[model samples]
Target: MFLPDVHAEPDTEVLFQFIKENPLGLLITGINSTSVDFLQCTHAPFVLDLPNAGDNTTPRLRAHVAKQNPQVKAMIETLDTKPSETITLDQEVLVLFNGRHDHYVTPKFYTETKPDTGKVVPTWNYSAVQIYGKLSLYYDSKTPETGAFLGKQMHDLSEQCERSVMGFTGDGDRPQPWKVSDAPERYVELLQRNVVGIEIEIRKVEGKFKMSQEMRPGDREGVVKGVSRALTQVGVTCMGIHLYVPRQ
Candidate 1:
């Protein structure tokens, strides 16, 4: 969260795209100031309500998980407390979405650069986003409206998943792939009974892209090339933002 000006990502679109690409996130909240706990869940990308088209206001995140998950019980207990006059929801909760990262930048990549010439060193590069917000929790079957909302949320996520997987299939005589609707009434009932939905009303969003942006152009280019050729998983990490080289 301590993002320096050099690494700050002010572009909301870029931050949102990063979150969409990496949906699994950690939801963190506190029962009191000292009792902070984390809940991990996979989020479904939803439209973030913005006051204006270009506003930098934090965007809301939507996600759901099974009722059996311990996090659900912990959250419900936290919500039961009476609202305090001093601390509002805006100051309480935080969600973190981490993307692909690696540790392959070697000092050799920057040791022969122009600006530093012979004094530069190596550093790891990565991307991540942190969102601070209010939370709204919904349990299905608690009320008619909430039940319907849960059903709709599940249906929407199902469609999103299907689109991601089915779009690649070439035309053939094969039957359409399985959809959420294909499930029997009992299965739907079971899902409805077991699922809990969470809505995070974001107040602040912070993005960090530590992709050698601070290094001299020559040093950065060398790091990128070296990382690209490395056989470790870090190769893909460098390759992804290779085109997003630092601005002079």
Candidate 2:
């Protein structure tokens, strides 16, 4: 999360939007004295639990994941050995959500288009966000509560997915659409057995939007147009594609 001033995004709205758009996150933690224990999780859009009046310093995050996932096992193992290391109900963790990115930026796109004198090399532009917070893991004693939480999380995720992808027409609006109760008992039991609820308290957030912000206006415009055309040729849309436009 080394965010240079040129690419730093301090706006909270922008950071939240990035997280909402990219719900899938990479949860990294040090395990077994190594820094490589990472879990790629499709996290449900979680709420930041903030203190009301007196307690404003500590913030927490809330989400859930499958209990059967290996990351949970790793966490449990870590907790068992080092109880002190276990993330408390309000301990912050780092959550990283990455957006679409690709290589293959050609210098010709900017250099040839712009009236530049010096030579220019290829570069790539992308966006990403790092959220630091504590997490809370929740478990239900009764099947009803478990079903309710799981159902709500799943429904929210499905709605997000549908809204993001175009041409989705599956139960967009319903007061009581597809509840866990609609499914068979066995399915609900299976979900209850496998799912693990998660909550994270975010203390700080860092966002990097490296979308040709360092380039001159003309150079940036050229790059945007070039990248857009190139991506379209390959049937893709890249970051900052909408930012480039020809002036009258």
What would the per-residue lDDT of candidate 2 be over residues 1-248, giving only the tens digit for each residue? Answer: 77788788888767877776677777654444232255434444554444667975665555667765666665665553432232353234678788766445566666544445656767777779888766655455144655565566656555555555433554456243344456787876676657666756677888988776666666776767777788788887565354522222
Instruction: Give the residue spans of candidate 2 off by over 4 A.
Output: 33-61, 80-92, 101-103, 112-115, 139-151, 163-182, 237-240, 244-248
Q: List, residue by residue over 79-135, the lDDT tens digit for candidate 1.
A: 544321111243357778887654458888774474455675557777899887887
Instruction: Output the TM-score of candidate 2.
Output: 0.72
Task: Give all candidates' CA lDDT scores.
Answer: 0.64, 0.61
Where does candidate 1 have its weakest 10-residue lDDT segment? 82-91
lDDT of model 2, residue 124 = 73
